[model samples]
Structures are given as structure tokens and as C-alpha cells.
Target chain A: MKLYDYILSGNCYKIRLFLSFLDINYETVPVDYYPGREHRFPDFLEINPLGQLPVLVDDEVKLRDAQAILIYLASKYDTSGRWYPRNPEAMGKIAMWLSFAGTEIMNSSNARLHDMLAYDLDADKARANAHAAFRILDDHLVEVGFAGQEWIAGTQPSIADVACFPYVALSRDGGIEHDDYPAIQSWLTRIQSLPRFIDMPGIHFMK
Target chain B: MSINFNKYHWFAFYASQQIMPAEIRARSMWNTDIAVWREENGSIHAWKNRCPHRGMRLSYGFIRGSQLVCLYHGWNYEGATAQCSYIPAQPNLKGPKTACVRDFACFEKHGLVWISTVAEAEKEPDFSDFGEAEQTIHFCRSIFVNESPGLVGEILKTSIFIPYGNDLADGAKLKIETSQAEHHQTGANYQAIWQSGRDKKKKTELTCQTEVRNNAILVNHYKDDQGNEGSLIFALLPIDDKKTGVHVLFSGDFSSQSLTSAKRHYAKWAKRMRWSIENRNLQTDSFNPWI
Candidate 1:
């Protein structure tokens, strides 16, 4: 499988973490985002007319969307509640959160940042947007921590952890702090110790 | 099911569309006083759990065409009026078409039956392809941050970063270079990248211009514009480590292709930056605690 990827994006990081955790081997295809031409190129468009990065084109099919990609991988791979499990109730729980991740974290965190960062709004709104997501997670963390256990869903780590691994860790990039969140802190400690654990991609200090 | 209050009162919850099969028929929570059932021919009827005169849970009643007769009383209730008919005690009296407990709305689809109190229905909720195609295989896990629905939608709309930790995992004390929000004019587009154990924003002068393909989704955020609240869209894209790598494109083109990629590509991307996601579960990860 070849991945059209950007190092700094957290959305793409979700998938990257899962692959490494599962021990899957693949090559990363770098799109020349700097020149801005590669993405619009006909060849690249042919693979994914959507023009999204982290486009995974493999022998069987071509796919896009981090959440969708995560679903496909966890489903195809056989794991006893390892990455993707087969239980009905358990599946629902995981689905609910994954949906939340796609809608809530992905949108509010970055949108708030864009409001300030892109000059759409003032700094207050950007921080407010970041805080909005923070409160949502803090409320959820009051109890039933990590699906009632060390992992996100079920008894062990699954794609749920992989899918959410990035934004959960590095929200501070948008100036959202994590010191106030104790359960979040605890949860972070647990996931950080994973065997194939990796750090976040750095910010563009000198764009 | 139908609910009965005092004085022959009638109450029904829209069960489904009134065309559901027997298997998914009882997904209604209509007060639980009466049982709703479908006759063999496909018409619906509500009967008391007991014979109108007797007291059986009409749900156990048998369906004979449009009329439902109590199993024990053998007293039939007409579907048209929900009125009692052919009562053994009052054999000669004709029953009203409304003698039977009437069937209401409610059915199963979007995972469960969603019933409304008002009669006559409007359009159903648009369950997007996003809802149908994706499945969260892991556990409920936790909420990352306390984000509102609209704001979260915006984040999704803007950009999704896959934290690629190839070097960072190896203990690279990569100084999280910081910068201020450029606050550019003309709807400026940019990506905010964060480093682990580091909290600061950095500005980088782009050496080149490029396209950042974004996700098709639009975040639905509501804010007070004037005296009223309004909505705006936050578009998103998925970025990979290879091109936008912590090792490489710390500053690079953000695109929509990142939002739409194969599962393998996303999985690979997830693999690269997972340590961070796991570590940074947001503050709003939870929902309705202490329930």
C-alpha cells in the first residue's frame, strides 16, 4: 500500500499509528505540497479525485478519509479485540466515539484555531473553540474512564485508540492546554506507553 | 404500544412508518400499556393486553385480518375504530369501527425506532454516507476535549493531521517552534501543527504555494453574529507525515486528499503518529457522565 501523506497532519497520524501498531508494512508517497502542483496533477487526481492526502491506494482498492481508512483496516485485520473486534455491543460503543472524534474533535479544535489563525475571528474565539472541545472531553472523563478500563474500548487497545491517538495528544498545538484535565492526563500516560508508540510531528517553525 | 389513561383516554407513539415487519415491529416505547401487532394481511391494529371486558395484554391478542380478537375472551376489536365487537356478554350490539386500540407510528432503521408525538410526519433525518460507511471498531474509549457539536464539525472541516512520530518516537527533542496566528486577509488557509511535550505556535514563511485538499464535510458551528446565532463551515483535510512529515513538511500544502484516502493509507498514517493521539485524548472525550 502506498500512502499519500503529510507529516504534520493529525488526521493522517491516526491511520499511521494504527498501521505501525498492527505491524503492517507500507510506503509513504510524498506529495509535493510545497509547489502546490502535485495535488492538482492528473496522475494524483486519478488515484483520488478528492485530492486528499493520506490516500491509500493498494492492490485491491483505493480509499480516502482517515476514519473510513481506520474502519477498513480494523475490520479486515483479525484481532481479538486488538484493533477491531467482532462484538455487536462493543462495536456500537466504538462507533459512537469514532463518530464523535470525526465530528467534534476534528471540527471544533481546528475550526476554532482557523478562526484566529486564519484571521476569521480574534484570538479569544480560537481559544474558546479549543476550550469547547476540552470541556466535552473533561465531562466524559469524570467517570467510565477509557471505556471503563485502561483501553478506549473493550479490555485491550483497538483502532479506537489508534483512530483518536493524535488530536487527543497534541491539541495544545492550537493553544489548547491539557494540565486541567487529570483523567485526560492519566489516559495519555496509558496510551503513551504503547509498544510502537511515537511522538507527534513538529509544527512548522520556519515555514 | 399504546398507553391508556383514565376515561378511555388514547395515546400512541409513532412506531415506525406503519409498514415495518413483525421482527422489528415492537421497537416502540408507546407508554407500554397496550400491545401493537400486525394482522396476517399487513394491516395494523392495537389491542389491549386483555379483552376489553377481560384484561389481557392486547399484544398477546391474535390478528385476524383487520380485527384483533382477544385470545381468551374471543371478543374481537375492530381495527377501523378500535371499538369492541362481538362481545360474548353483549352479542347483539354492533361495535364501533373505532372499537380497537389503534396502531400508531414507529419503526426501525437508523439503528432504532424514532417515534414522534405529533400526527403526520415530516422528512426523516438525513443519515449521511459518513454515518453508514464508517464503524468505530474500538471501545467508547474517552472524549479528547469538551467540544460543542458545531465547533467539532468545524475542526473536521478544516484539517485532520496524522501525527507521524518516526523521529519523535526515537526521543527527538524537537523544539516545538512557535508562531502567532498570521491573521492573514482573504480567508487565509494554514495548518496548525503541535509537538509532544511542547506547547507553542510557530510561523513559517512558505517557500512555495500548494493546494491543501480538504474533507467534504463541513463543520456546523453556531455563533452569535449580531443579536442572533449563525453557522459557519470549518473544512478539513488529512495530512500525512511523508509529505507533511515532522521529519519533513512541518510546513506544507494541506489538501482534501487527506480527508479522502484509502483505509490502508489512513491506517499507515495513524501508525506514524498514534503515540500522540493515545497520549492526547481530548478533554471532551466523555459524554453524559454519572448516568
Candidate 2:
């Protein structure tokens, strides 16, 4: 397996973290997504017309989008069927939240780009939208906790947890604090404690 | 009797199954911040999220046994009353009476955790019409909408023929029997009866009651037919002026197939409703159903 990776990109980090959890060995083909803007270069554009980082190529299967890669990896590799449950209800939930992480959470990542990478955008509005998303997530997690389920989708952690984890854990980089969302804070701790969990630049292992 | 903070009846805020841990949870209703928590002994409490000591949100606090301790200053509040019990800063000095957090009346029934700003009235919002308490209750995931509860109510009243998809019998036709909206001093109630199936003898009757209280809407549904007799309740919580949280619960003697089908059906219906509410460009006039 080959991963077109960016060390600092949260989307890239989600793939890295999930791969580590599955104990899968994959060679990293580094993409300079930041200062060099290498993802937009001709070579990277050939791999993905969208020029998104974290493209996964496993044998004959080449995938774009972090969420798509996650579903593929979990379904193909995870024998336990815990990471991406096939049940209709759980799949529906995971799919809904994956869209949430891609769209609403990507807005927060845009705010992070403005703050950390000096990208030109309305950081305040992006932060506000991120906070709104966090509010909903925190409320939902509280209910999930009450139901004796520790993961995002079902009784176990699923790809939905992985998809939404990175941006929310690194929200502080975008000037979005998790202080107002205690349930999110607790959830981050739980995700950090998962076995074989790997850390990126912003998300750290829990003590 | 106007639709203010005090006139609203019991409003289901969260599912009972979701309040599993003994921790403080934050929620909003009609733009009012609320901190909901369950004690270790399984008692639930809802209070104003604001801390009286320093105006910090109590939802950011941690729970210790039966007390909620403020995150900022460690001002401990008892679970039931939300009265200040101990202050870490001034342990010897008794916590002042004025330091108590404003608490709301909370109750749990039919797999729902309800909170009300006012005292309980002579009679609670009736759920007895649904079913008995011991039946299996399936609580669906809540959906959030970027629309007012009144607007959602009007949409539901006017658009009664929305399909249930695979949840109904094959080739079943949905027909609205009676649609009525009665306005009270506090809020309004929209009631409608819908029947499905070409065979009138075996037609499934679905009765819907939507109560628009303050800024929230509660819809209770009763279904009776040859195959199933049960009820489903929906509680809409207004998080702010532009956002609403919807909680759903189903109670009845249901087969596993019907339960799974019901969950799938409502989840899609909610997504569609939310999209229509957010994108539709309709008249902004007051929701007067009589006209």
C-alpha cells in the first residue's frame, strides 16, 4: 500500500492513524501540501484531479477522499467488522457524520489554514461555524455516552470516529477552543486511549 | 398565558438512554442555556448553565458523585437542587443562598428526559395516549435543523402526504383525513389523521398531534391498523433563533423488522424535512393554519 501523505494535514493524519490502528504497513509518499504547494503540482494532480492529500493506492485499488479510503481499508482489512459496521443504521450514521467531517469540519480546517498557513479567508466566520459543529457533536456524544456506546457510530468505534477525530482534536490550531465542549474533550481522550493509536503534530497521546 | 418561558409544558430535551454517564451535559431550549446531568444514583438534573459565582458555564464543570463542581473555581452544587454545597475557595465559609444555580423541573418517561422552566401543572403533557411504560421503546437519533419550530410545525401541517417509504405496506396510499390547528394563548396545537392502504378495512391509521410550545414543537403520533398499534413521539428543541434539535421515540409491540424499518424511514424523512426547511423560499408570514 502507498499513501500520498502530508505530515501536518489532518486529513492525511486520519489515514495514518487508522492504518496504525489496523497494524497495516504502508509506504508514505510525502506530498509537500503546505509552503511548497506540491499537491497542486502536475505529478500530484495526475494521481488526484482534485489534488487532495492522503490519496491511498492499495494494489489495483486507488482511492481519493480520506473518508472513502477509511471505508475501503476497514472493510477489506478489519476481520472483526468493528471499524466499519455493515448494519444499515450504523452505516447511515457513519455516512452522515463522514459528510459532516468533510464539509462542516473542512470549514474549520480552512480557518486553521488562515491562522497557521496564512491562507486568505474569513477566519472568524470559519471559527464560528466550527464551534457550531462542535456544539452539535458534543451534545450527540453526551447521548452516545449515556447509551453505553463509547464509539461514534455503534457499540464500537467506527470510521466515523476516525473521520471526525482529527479536525476536532486539532481545533485549537484554528482558534477554536474545546473548553465549551466537555463531551468532545472526553471523546478526544477516549480516542487517544484506543490501542495502537498514532499521534500527529497537533493531536497528542493522552497521559 | 402567552408563549413565554413559563407557559410551556413538559418538553423532552434528550433521550433517557443518552444520559447514561454521571456527567454534566449542556443543551439549549428557546435560546436558554441548560446544563443536564445524571447523578451516580441515576437521578437527572437540568439547570441554567451559568455559574452564579463567576458567570462560567456549569456545563463545563465536572461531576463528583452527586455534586457538580464548577470547572473554574470548584464551587460544588448538589445534584437535585443545584444549590451551592461547598466552595473550595472558602471551605469554612458556608456557601451563600444566592449562589445556587437556577434549576428546572425534570422528568423521565417513555425513554425521554424532559425539562421544563416552570413548575409542573395540574396534569403533565399526556403521553398515556401513546402506550404503557413497559413496552419496548426505540429512540431514534435526533436531527438538528436550521429553522424555527413554528415554521417546521407549519410545514408538517401543510405537507401531510409525505411518504413513509418502505415502512408502510406495499402500494399503500397516504390520505389526510382531518387537519386542524388550534391556537392557545401560550402556543398552538396542530392535529391531523392520516390513513394508508387501498383496503379501508385494513388501512393503517396514523394520528399526529403537534404542540408548538414557546419556541419548541412536540409531535406525538399514534398508529393503529391490522398489523401494528403503537405510538411515536417527536420533540423539537429550539437551540436558538435559527436552530432546532429534534428528538424521536417509538413505543409499541414491534417486530424487529418493523423497528429497523421505522428507524431507517424516520432518519431519511428527517433529513428531507431539514433540507426543505433550510432551502425553501416560502412566505415569512406568521404560521396561522386557519387561513
Candidate 3:
């Protein structure tokens, strides 16, 4: 297996983090997603039409999109069936969060791109939307915790947790403060405490 | 004005069990970053989190058995001395002594791990009261407060009143007998007494002592009523200038059932105190003179 990864990209980090949790060894092909813009070149576009990062190639299977790759890896590799459960209710809940990760979280990640990579965008509006999304997620997490559930989907941590983790954890890069969201901070801590968990550049281990 | 690091000569940074993981953990004290880790042999160490080479965070490094290896350059540091034992880039050459990571004086006692920035500090803080009843020590969940340690100390001096076990006999009353505050070079110390019941014929005594040592607070509780004796220790660690972490250690001669009740009561009390401290508008002038 080979992962086209960019260390600074939170979307790429999501797949890398999940692979680490699964203890699966795969070669990383570093993509210069910054000033170089290698992902847009013809060679990379052949692998991914969307010109996005974190394309995973396993034998005959080539998967795009971090969320899709997370589902595929958890479905095929996780013997415990906990990461991507087959139960319909669990899958529905997980799917909703996955879509939330792609839509609501991508707005926050775009702000990070503007700040860190100097990408031109309306950062203030992106940040405001990010905060709105975070408020909803934080309130949802508080309710879930009251129900004695720690993760986003079902009783155990599923791909839903992996999907939404990176952008939320790295929201500070976009000038988003998580100080007001105690539940989100606690959720970040719980994710860090998972066995075989790995951190990206901005996300450090919470003591 | 910069903080006097020596004021934290002997401070409790974390509970001993907190460093149980074999991987390196990160902690901050007075704005100084520290990398804490426990080796396979169960020995704990605290070092400056910055690697001597290129200033990479050592907490981001990995532990290879007992040696901590920096993730950036693979500089291996031995556990006890924090001396660079091997540099993978130069495997054949012996790593220079000066290449070692700076270490702090660390010692574990009474269920807490302490770190001192000053090297010549001869001994750890005298937690002898808690040490005397080692077998009964029970640690409560730590509380983190987003407030200055000094402000938290002031609040504790004036507003903190932890209740004794709820299982006290019927018609029993716990009243504060004496409250005394003293100032020391580092911080302040408060001592208080609580007398149970109005009847002088059958009286019970509860004594509480709190030591505010710079960025940390050490609390000791003692109860002597009808041949029942107990002790509890609460240690606070300053995570940074404005954030504080608190840990509780309870020791006493009480039945298991009573101990459970005491633990639950103190845990809730600690949470409430933390919430109050974090939410209160703390003014420097409002601090007690002694504190």
C-alpha cells in the first residue's frame, strides 16, 4: 500500500492517523502541496481527478477522498469491525458525520490554507462558519456524553471520529479557539489517548 | 517582571501514575516546557522538552526501551543522566557530553512526582504527614483550572471549606475552630481546625493545613474524632502562567465504605472549587495579605 501524503494537510493527516491506529505499514509518497503545486500537475492528476491529496493505492484498488479511504481501510483491514461497523444505524450516524467533515470542516481547513500557505480566500467568513459548525458539534458531543457515549458514532469510536478529528484538532491554525468548547477539548484528549494514536504537526499530545 | 524560577524549588508537577506510559509526555511549568517519561525499569525523568540540537521538541521523540530518541535527528538520550548516548547520524563516534539534554531534579513521593529547576535543592518538600499513612493513600481525579495559581490560593484561603465525611454520626456538627494564615518566602500557609458537635463531653477534631508554594499548593487534612483518624493531601501544579492543574491524595484509617463516600465528596468539592476559581473575577488587590 502507498499513500500520497502531505504532512501539513489535515485531510491527508486523517488517513495517515487512521493507518497508524490500525498499525498498518504503508509507504508514504510525499506530495508538495504547497508552493510547488505538484498535485495539480498532469502526473498526479492522472491518479486523482480532483487534484486532492491522500490518495491511497492498495494493490489493484486506488481510493480518493480521505473519508472514502478511511471507510475502505477500516472495512477491509480492521478485524474487530469497530472502526467501520456494518450495523445500519451505526453506518447512518457515521455517514452523517463524514458528510459534516467534508462540508463543514473543509471551510475551516480552507482558512488554515489561507493562513499557513498564503492561499487567497475570505478567511474571516471561513472562520465564522467554522465556529458555527464547531458550536453544533460541541453541543452534539455534550449531548452524546450525557448519553454515556464518548465517540461520534455508536458506543465505540468509528470512522466518524477519524473523519472529523483532524480539522477540529487543527482549527487553531485557522485562528479558531477551542477554549469555549470543553466537550470538544475533552474529545480531542480522548482521541489522543487512543492506543497507537499519532499526531500531526499542529496537534500535540494533551497532558 | 519575570517569575523567579527558584521560587518553585520543590514543586509537585504531576501524580506518579500520570507518567506510567512508556512514551514521552509533555508538561509545562512557569512557561518552561518539560518532557516527562517513565522508562521500562519504572524510573521517571524530567528534562527540558527542547532537544539540544536544532531545538526540536523532545516530547515529539520516541522511547526506544529506556533511551529517548529525538524524532528529528535520532539523538538517543540515556534515561538517568539524560546524556546523549548515541547519535544515529554518527553511530561510530561517541556523542559528546555537552550534547545531552538538560535535566531537572525529579523525585516521587507520597503518590506525587516533583520537579525542581534548582539543582542544589537538597530535599523534596516535607510531606511527612501524608508519608506517615502511606498504605491508605488514595488519589482523586485531578482538576485543571484556567486561573492563576496565586489567585487560586487566595480563593482557597478565603472561600474553600471542604466538608468532612457525610457519614458522621447523627446530630454531629463540624464548625471551624481556628483559622490561621502565615506567609513564607515562597507563598502562604493556612492552618484551620474544625470541632465536631457542640457537646464538650464527646468532641471530635479536624485539622487542615494548606501550603501555597509558588505555583503549587499542598494541602493536608487530618481528622481525629472518637478514636478515628484520617489524612488527605491535595497538590496543585501550575501548567502555565494562567492555567493550574490539581491532584488529590487521600490517606486515612476509615472503613472501605466510608472511604468511598469521602472520595466522592472530596472529588465533587474539588470540582466545585475549581469552577468557582475559574469563574470568579480575581483582583490582585483582593488577595489575602498573607497569601
List residue ranges in candidate 1 displaced over 4 A: A34-37, A40-42, A108-127, A146-148, A202-207, B1-291
Q: Which window of ten consecutive residues has the lowest lDDT sum in model 2 chain B?
A: B282-291
Which pairs of residues collide in model 2?
Answer: A146-B20
**Between prediction 1 and prediction 3, which has the larger DockQ?**
3
lDDT per residue for candidate 2 within A1-207, as digits (tens), equals 999999989999999999999999999999888788998989999999998888999999999999999999999999889898888988899999999999988878988999999999999999989988887787677556544567778778889999999999888789886645555766787798899999988776643
Local distance difference test values of all predictions, in order: 0.45, 0.72, 0.72
Q: Residue by residue across B1-291, what tens digits does model 3's lDDT show?
A: 112334546777765655555656666777788877888777889999999888988877777778888889999999977898998889998989888888998888766778887778746676555534455677654556678765555555443244454333334433443345554444334433333334435544444444444435455444444343454455666667787666766666557666656666666566556655654556332322111
Task: Give the CAPRI class of candidate 1.
Answer: incorrect
Task: Mark the regions of model 2 whose C-alpha exceeds 4 Å error after superposition.
Answer: A1-104, A112-120, A124-160, A169-207, B1-8, B85-98, B119-123, B131-137, B157-230, B282-291
For model 3, report DockQ.
0.08
The sequence of per-residue lDDT tens digits that candidate 1 reaches over residues A1-207 is 878886666777777777777778889887775346577789888977877666876788789888778888777764644677777877887887787677666644464345434535455554665556655555454334422455666667777766665776667556555533444554655676677765555311110
Rank the models by lDDT, top first: 3, 2, 1
The share of true interface contacts that also appear in candidate 3 amounts to 0.00
- Residue by residue across B103-216, what tens digits does model 1's lDDT show? 445343322233333356444433232111342211111122222223332322222332322112222222211242222211223233323333223212211111212211
- Which stretch of 10 consecutive residues in model 2 chain A shows the poorest summed lDDT? A139-148
**TM-score of model 1 relative to the true fold?**
0.39
Top candidate on TM-score is 2
